[model samples]
Target: MRTAYSVEMVRAAERELMARLPDGVLMQRAAAGLAAACADVLGRVYGRRVVLLVGSGDNGADALYAGARLARRGAGVTAVLLAPDRTHPEALAALRRAGGRTVPGADAEEPLRRADLVVDGIVGIGGTGGLRPDAAALVDVIGETRAAVVAVDLPSGVEADTGEVHGSAVRADLTVTFGAHKPGLLVDPAREYAGSVRLVDIGLAFPGEAELEALQHADVARLLPVPAAESDKYRRGVVGIAAGSSRYPGAAVLAVAGALRGGAGAVRYVGPAGDAVLARFPETLVSTGTPEQAGRVQAWVVGPGAGDDADAVAAVLGTDVPVLVDADGLRLADRDAVRARRAPTLLTPHAGEAAALLGVAREEVEGARLRAVRELAERYAATVLLKGSTTLVASPGDGPVRVNPTGTGWLATAGSGDVLSGLAGSLLAAGLDALDAGSVGAYLHGLAGRRAADGAPVGAHDVAEAVREAWRDVTD
Candidate 1:
């Protein structure tokens, strides 16, 4: 698993570590790592034209010290000092001693135009909102240069704790983060600006849990269900899917398709699209009656092109088994009934659906996904899977929220979420908690989407079909 800590937590850890080390030792360690990474990006330090964007913070000192290292290696380094008077005195002296020259931010264009690489140290973890106007101008100039950009710690102008980018920010080809990952580096908006990330350990120890966690292959593999040798169909688990309407029978077919591929022993589907589902998958136990008459099931998946089937949504929510709500179900299901349930409930919604639930604009949810998802989980007193470029799973607690790292833009296709609903529901039936089920299901679903699309367009059925491959890939 990959973990990210908040700015306050990182600062506390850094301060404790700095107290134990000699003066300037920690900064040297960071500079060394930054210089090494810059060398790698340049391929050869000798005769390279490197430009450093230096600010009035420790990050600027880091850049100056790193530039000194490169200068000693025979690179022609120039520092574009945004705050000449406030720049680190010792760091500037070190750079000058190593033959690195400094140019004011106003005179940066000439050096920037001829640079082979540009290192962004304009802002650090303490920065918020966006870049200052003077700094913003330099970023604009840097954009015109054909240099490969490397940002120190994180891209300038993004919120380290919240991943929000309010205004103009430096977009780097690569970001060299120190000690630990920041929430902004792992989440989107800011994540998009940070093209690629490389972590450099400076030996800062963090005590408590991370603010956010992203599951990798090994973590998902551990969560997946593998039936025991003596386990029968009933012993394994059964997932009940109540979905589809005459208007959208394909939703039911797609949901059942994903459920069949999941680790469930059997899939019992109840909806008006029974005949369509039966045609696609004859093995499914079909019923036209309410979910109450669907016999026994370990978990239930409601919604997914359900139209306005309020009765069906109500009936599924009332069940004692764990239930997942999605699509039309999100609109039809009652919040009080959902909050009133003792059994676990999982709510899956895209940005638009989530906006509707929270009674806000879709842009608001998209802009602040972490806050939105957390608010939804707390309000409903249930787990929420906010589906998008980065799928987030948050339960009704202060625990670290799980972020799914896998996925492609191709997943934006229709009926894709319906498949996810069934897959997660099956995991719930297999006994994984709402958090684990939602994250793992998203992980697999994303990998399957990538495999099925492979740079081309693919249908929802293709993604569902590729889940088996994703499962095997993880297990192996």
Candidate 2:
């Protein structure tokens, strides 16, 4: 699992470590790493045109020192100091001695336009709000050029803790981050600006758990449900799906399709679309009744195309087993009832649905997804899965929130979410907690979407069918 720390946490660790190390030791380590990453990106350092966007902070010092190293190796390095007087004194002297020229930030246009590589060291983790006007204009200049921008630590003008990009920010081809990952680099908006990230360890140790985590394939493999040799159909766990209606029966088929592939022993589907479910998956135990009459099930997946069936959704939530709510269920389910449930409740809401639940605009929820997920989880006292390009699973607990990175944009298609709901419900029935089930289900669903699309358009049914392949790929 790849873990990310908050800015406050990282700073504390850095301060503690810096106190123990010799003067300038940490900066030297960071500079060396930054220089190496720039060299790798340039392929050949000699004769490379390197321009540094020098700021007033340590980030600029890192860039200046790294620029000096490149200058010594025969690269033409120029430092465009945004704050000339406040620039790192020793770093400037070193760069001058190494034959690197320094220029004012306002006069950076020509050098920026023709540079082979532009280093963004304009802002650090402590930066808040957005970039100043001059910095924003410089960023605009960088954008107009073909230079491959490399940001030190993180992309300038983005919130290091929240992944929020207000006003303008630098878009880097590669970001050479130090020590550990920041929450911003692992999430969207800020993450999109970061492009490809390479972690450069500066030997800062963090205590306790990380603020955020992204599960790798090995972590997914460990959490996957593997049936025991002696396990029977009932023993493996059955997932009851309360979805689909006469108006939209395809949802039932798709949800059942995903459930069938989910490691669950059997899938019990209860809705008005029994014929549609039977037509697609003959193996599914079908019923045109409520969840209570749908026989025994370890978990229930409510809503996919149930329309305004709040009563039916409430019936499933009354059960003691883990329950997952999505689509119409997210809109219609009574909040009080959901909060009153004894069993684990998982709410999967897209930005719009989440906005409806929180009484905020969709943009607000989408902009601060980390805050939205955590607040939703805490508000309803249930696990909240905010589905998007970067899916997030947060529970009402102290553990790290899981951020899934396997998603592709093709998953924005219709019925894709229904497939995800079923798969997550199946995992819940198999006895994984709400957080694990949501995270693993999202992981598989995304991988399957990628596999199914393979750069082409794919239907939701294709994504559902590809779940088996995704499972095999993960476990392999």
Candidate 3:
């Protein structure tokens, strides 16, 4: 897993390292790592012109020290100190000793325009709101230049804790962050500003808990369900799916389509459209009774297309196993009853359903997906998977929200959600927790959808058929 700490945690970690090491040791290490990355980008540092956009604070110091390194290596280095008097004294002295000169004003724009590369050190973690007037003007000049930009720490002006961009920030081609990753580097809005991220270990030991994390392929591979040699159909896990009606029998087929590919041992279908479900996948066991009468199941998936079926919703929720609620189930839910349930509940809602649950408008939910997912999790006291362009899964208790980065717009077909619910419910039955189950299911679903579409418009059945291929890719 790729772990991300909050800004406060990063500061605390830096302080702890600073106290133990010699004065300026951490900054030296950061600068050395940064300079090495710059050298790699410049190919041969000798005879190359480099411009550093200096601001006040340690971020500027990092740039100044890096410039000194490049100057000593035969590069033509210059620092444009935005705050001349406030520039880091030690860094300025070192730069001057290495034959680097300081230029004044946006007049330094000419040097930047002529430079081979630009180092954006305008703001750091201490920065608040947006760019100052002078800084914004400098950024405008830098943007007009053709030099590749490398940002120190995060791209300036982005919220380190959340991924929100309050004001204009530099868009860097490469961002070199010290110690560990920040939330903004992994999330949207701000992530868009950070083209690519590189982490430099300054040997800072952080003993505190992480606030956010992004799961890598290896992490997802480990969490996937694998059957044992002694395993049987019942031992593997049974997933009960209660979905569809006469009005929407396709929902039942789509949901079952997803369930059959899930690593679950068996899929039990219950509802009015059992015939439709069985017709698509003969492997599924069909039942005409309620979800409770569908016999014992490790997990239950409710509410894909049971339109206004109060009895169906109640029967599914009445069970004590892990439950996944989606679509019509979201609207017909009794909030109090859902909260009062003993089993783990996973709520999957698109923008419209999420709006109704949060008592906000759909636009509000879509505008800020991170906030919407968190709000839904906190309000329902359940794991929430807010489906959209960027699908987010958050649990009320703790941990960083899991963002699905593998989906395409082509997945927006009819009955696609039903497949997701079934896949997630299967993972739950396979004994994964609500958060892991939801995130893993989304990862697999997205991979499947991508394979099924392959740059063409695909139906729900194609997505269902592609799940096996996606599973193979993950397990292999």
Candidate 4:
């Protein structure tokens, strides 16, 4: 897993390491790593014109020291000190000792435009709101320049803890971060500003508290359930799906289409569209009554195009099995009813449905997906998978929120969500917890969607068909 440490946790880790090391050792390590990355980007650091946008804190110190390294290697380095008086004294002296020159504000623009590369050191984890007036002006100048910009630590003015952009932030072509990854480096808004992130280890070990995290292929592959040699159909797990109506029989087919390939031992279909589901997948155990009448199942997938079928929804919600609620089911769900369930509950809602659950506007949910997913998990007391361009799975407990790295725009086709709900519910049935089921399901679904389309348009059935291939990619 790719872990993200919060600013507070990073600070504590820095403090602990600082106490054990020499003064400025951590900063020097950070600077050296940053300088090497900069040199790689510049191809040949010697004879290159580099401009360092220095702020008032240790972030500026990092840039100044890195600039000094480049200067000693034959690059012409100039530092534009935003706060000269408050600038790091040792770092400033180091830069001068290495043949680096400082230019006042009035002389900054020309040098910045003419430089081959620019280093942004405007803010670090200690930064509050957006760029100050002077910093904004400097950023605007950098924005207009043709030089590639590299940000020290994170892109300035981004919320390291939440991935929220405070105000106007510098858009760096590359960001060299220290210690560990920040939430902003992986999530959106801030992620858009942070182009490519490279982590520089400063030997600061964080024992606890990871604010954000992204699951790697290995992590997902490990968490995915696989059948043993002695496992039989009944011994593995059965997933019961309650979905579709006469008006939307295709939803049931699509849901079953996904459930069949979800590593489940068996799939039980309980709804009005039993014939439709049977037509699609003859292996599925089709039932004509409510979800309760479908007998025992390890998990349940509820609310995919059931229309206004409150009775079926209630029956599914009433079950003691782990349940994944999605699509139209999100609209009819009672927050208290979901909360009262004995088994683990997983909610999969697109931005619009998530907004309804939160009683907020869709724009609000989309604007801050991280906050919305967390709030939804907290409000309903269940794991929530907020699906969109970037699928996020949030649990109410501690640890980093999961951001799915595998997704394509093609996954937004009709009935795609039903497939996802069924897949996740099947995983839950196969004994994965709510969070793992949702995230793994989403990851596979996205990969399947991409493979199904292959840059062209594909219907929901194609995505379902590609699940096996996606699974192979993960498992193999």
Candidate 5:
């Protein structure tokens, strides 16, 4: 698993490491790594024009020290001082000693245009909101340049804790993060600004749980349920899907399609679309009744293409087994009832649905997804899987929020979310907790979408059919 720490945690770890080491040792280590990364980006560093956007913080010192290293290597390095008066004195001196000169921010346009690489150190993790007018002007100049940009730590103007980008921010081709990964670097919005990220070990030790966790292949493989030879169909687990109506019968077919391949022993579908579902999947145990009458199911999935089926939503919520509520169920499910349930309840909502639940606009949810998902989980007392470019699963407790790293734009198809709802519901039946089920389901769903699409457009059924392929790829 890939983990990210909050700025406060990172600072504490940094302070502890710095206390044990000699003075200036940590900064030098960061500078060495930064210089090496810059050299790699330049390919042939000799005679390359490198520009460093210097500021008043430690990041500015890092960039300046890295510029000195490049200068010694025959690259013509120049530091464009955003804060000329407050620049790191020792770093500036070191740059001059190594034959690198400084240029004022006012005269930066010419050098920025001619630069082969631009190092962004205008702001660091401590800086918040957007860039100041002077820094913004310099960044505006850098924007027009064809130079490949490298940011120190994280891209400037993006929130370090929650991946929110306010106004003007530096868009980097690559970001060299020190010590640990920030939450901003792993999520979207800010993640989009950070192009590609490389973590440099600066000897800081994180003591406890990370603020954010992203599951990798090994983690997912460990979480996936594999049946033993003695296990029967009922022993493996049965998932009950309460979805589809007269108007949208395809939703039932798609949901069952996903559940059939989710490592579950059997899929029991209870809905008004019984005929349609049976026609598509004869293996499904179909019933035209409420979830309670669907026999002994280990878990239930409700609310895909359910339309105005409020009774079905309420019935599924009342069941003792773990439940996944999505789509129309997100609208119909009572908050008090959901909070009162003893079993685990997972709520999956898109940005629009989440906004409706939060009484906010859709843009607000999209911009601050981490905050929105956390708020929803706390309010409903359930695990929330906010679906988007970066799917996030947040539980009610103080545990780390899980972020799905695998995803593709091709997942934005109709009925794709229905497939996810069933897959996660099946995992829930297979005995994984709400958080694990939601995150693992998202990981497989994303990989399946990528496999199905393969850079081309595909339907939701194609994605469902590819889940087996995704599972094989993971376990293989």
Candidate 6:
């Protein structure tokens, strides 16, 4: 699994390492890594034109030092110092000795326009808000240039902690980060600015825990609910899906399709679309009654095109078994009912549904997905899986938030989320906690979506069928 440390955690690690080392040793190590990454990007560094956007912090100092290295290797490096007087004196002298020159931020247009590469050192983790007026103008100049931009640590004007990009920010084709991954580089808004990222180890020790975690194949494989020789249909687990209506019978079919592949022994679908579900997946035990009368189930997936059936959603929530609420369920379920549940509750919401829950604008939820999910999780005292380009799972507890890395744009199609709810609920039935079930389910669903689409448009059914392939690939 890949992990991201918070700024505070990173700084503490850096400080501890720096205290043990000789003065300037850590910075040199960082600069050496930064320079190497830049060299790789440029391919041919000799006689190449490189522009550096230098600020007042250590990030700027690292850029200056890296530029000095590039200058010594025969690159024509020019540092555009945003705060000239506050620049690192030692780094400035080192750059000049290595045959590099400086340009004021005011007269940066010419050098930036003619550059083959640009290095962004304007803001690091310490800085807050968006770009300053002068820096914003310089970013505009960088945009007009054909230079391949590389940011140090993080792109300027991005919320390093939250991945929130406000106003103007530097957009880099590559970012060479030091120590460990920041939350911004792995998330959206800030993630979009950082095109491709390379982590340069500076020998700083990270904490055992980080602010965020992204699971890989090995992690997901371990979390998957594989059956034993002794396991039977009832012993494995049953997933009850309370979904669809006569008007939207496909929802029940789609949910059942997903639940069948979710490692559950049986799928007991209780809804108005029993005939529809049986038509598609005959293995599903269809029920036309309420969730309470649907016999025994290890877990319940409530509301996906159930229309205005709030009573069904309430009944499912009242059950002692783990429950996953999505779609019309998110719209109809009472907040108090969700909070009062003694069993594990997982809420799956898209940006619009999340907005309704938070009483905020859709743009607000979309822009700050991390905050919205965490807030919702804390408020509801449950696990929240915010479904979008980047699927995030956050619980009300102290563990690191899980950010799913496997997703494709084609997943934006209709009924995709309905498939996800059933899959995760089935995982919950198979004995994974809310966090594990949601995170693992998302990982598989995204990979399945990718395999199903393969650069073409795929229906939700195709995506559901591909889950078995995704599971095989993971286990293999």
lDDT of candidates 1 onward, in order: 0.94, 0.93, 0.87, 0.90, 0.93, 0.93
lDDT, candidate 3, 112-151, per-residue tens = 8899988888788767677888888877887898888889
Better of 2 and 4 by lDDT: 2
Candidate 5 ranges beyond 4 A from true positions = none
TM-score of decoy 1: 0.98
Per-model TM values vs. the true structure: 0.98, 0.99, 0.90, 0.94, 0.99, 0.99
- Tens digits of lDDT, candidate 1, 258-298: 99888889999999999999999999999877899999999
Residue-level lDDT of model 2, residues 142-183, one tens digit each, is: 989999899999999989988888989999999999999999
Error of 2 at 132 (Å): 0.5
| Least accurate 10 contiguous residues by lDDT in model 5 | 285-294
The residue ranges of model 3 lying beyond 4 angstroms of the native Cα positions read 245-248, 361-368, 388-390, 408-415, 449-463
Query: Where does model 2 exceed 4 Å of error?
Result: none
lDDT of 5 at 108: 90
**Winner on lDDT (3 vs 6):** 6
Query: What residue pairs clash in candidate 6, if any at all?
Result: none
Clashes of each: 0, 0, 0, 0, 0, 0
Model 1 segments beyond 4 Å from truth? Answer: none
lDDT of 5: 0.93
Query: Distance from true position, residue 165, model 1, in Å?
Result: 0.6
Task: Check candidate 3 and list the clashing pairs.
Answer: none
lDDT of 5 by residue, 1-476 (tens): 89999999999998998899998899999999999999999999999999999999999999999999999999999999988899999999999999999999888989999999999998989888888998888778878989999999998888889999888899999999999999999888889999899999998999889999999999999999999999999998999999998988888889899899888899999989999999889999998777877799999999999999999999999989999999989999999999999999999999999999999999999889899999999999999999998899999978999999997998999999999999999999999999999999999999999999999998999999999999999999
